[model samples]
Target: MTNELTDRGQERRDSILDAALTVFVRDGYHATKLTDISREAGCSVGTLYTYFENREELLAAVLQKVQAEIGNASDEPLEEDFNRISYADALRASNRAYLVGYRANAKVMALLEQAAHLDEQIYDHRVARIRRYIDRNRRVIEQLSERGEIYPIDDPFMFTTALSVMISRLAYYTWVEGFFDDSDETLERVAKTIDDIWFRSLGLKTD
Candidate 1:
């Protein structure tokens, strides 16, 4: 539906999406209305309807935008050779990227948690995102095992799933719930702790 928009139309659509996200984060998802988003976007309710079918669709789009922003913050170059990097360095980089991204999107992440419980679509989307991360980590674990870089696990997929969930919960606690301070020093310490756990779990020697 959005594919046919001209550049200006696309911009308007994006603005509406941004407004929707802002409102969602400020007010809980069920409490937010299209009128609220329209006011936030400086557009009319009719204009919002032109860009989105309904509040649910707008919320889904906002979720997608948040996920895309997080992905951009955390994604590494495809061509980079993970095998050549020290395990500790690789783990440090990954943990730092994830925590930084989570911190940047802390409010939205909290909103997502709320929406996931109230909306089936949001819940499915969140589950799918986690599955994708687990699959990616599992593949990496398999590759590293093949190269004799990490200890052979009895169930790589299960191990990856457990670790991925742990990291995600830790990020949620530290960032979304504000369980700890968000200073750079605190973030570095969190990343190092995650690195140490990853190294020990995978039976990789740390330098």
Candidate 2:
């Protein structure tokens, strides 16, 4: 009985997170309140508190939810299957996935940026999560280098970190910048920038 209750409670928590993401994206995080999320989730404020201690925690939960969704389709092993594909192609493929994920969760991404400014802890966690993800894929990057598909770099880990941060900034500007709306053209530009950086950094020509 206790286990069932716990599971149900968790489900409710997840639902609240989904609703919260929508609200945050629609209204921005600072403008959003627990009451707003509760109403959106079809739960009482008290019920919302039963799962999350505060708005900050709720935002974190929402961010985690978005991250999970973004990674859902990224579970395939790195494309070491064939040796013919250029390193630029592999990098482009990975970055295209990122652009898709960002588009899918634009609202959540906006909310996360808003939350990061209001709370130091949240900001730190967001940075750490990004760095960790890059580190996790460092080996795949090195493997591509080994295949001679891409050029080798002095420190692939740091290169990955820099690349991640740069792409994130590109997405932010493209999506949130005033008078500069995000579009397929902008996404392609960002992808090209990434390819250029990777190609040059690895001593590979853009040809």
Best by lDDT: 1
How much does candidate 1 score in TM-score?
0.90
Q: Name the regions of candidate 1 deviating beyond 4 angstroms.
A: 1-3, 77-79, 82-84
Which lDDT tens digits does candidate 2 get at residues 1-207?
123447788888778988987888888876888889889999999998777778887788778777766654443324545456554565667667767787767767766777788898689868876876676567667766776756657877778778767767777676665335567777788778866765676666444
List lDDT for all candidates, in order: 0.81, 0.72
What is the RMSD of candidate 2?
3.4
lDDT of 1: 0.81
Per-residue CA lDDT of candidate 1, range 1-207, in tens?
A: 455999999999989988888888888888999999999999999998897888877888888787776665555632257657664566567667778888888888888888889888889878987897788678767767887989889978889999989988988898888899878887887788787778889988777
Off by over 4 Å in 2: 1-7, 72-88, 204-207
Q: Ten-residue segment with the worst summed lDDT in candidate 1?
A: 71-80
Task: Look at candidate 2 and tell me the lDDT of residue 13.
Answer: 77
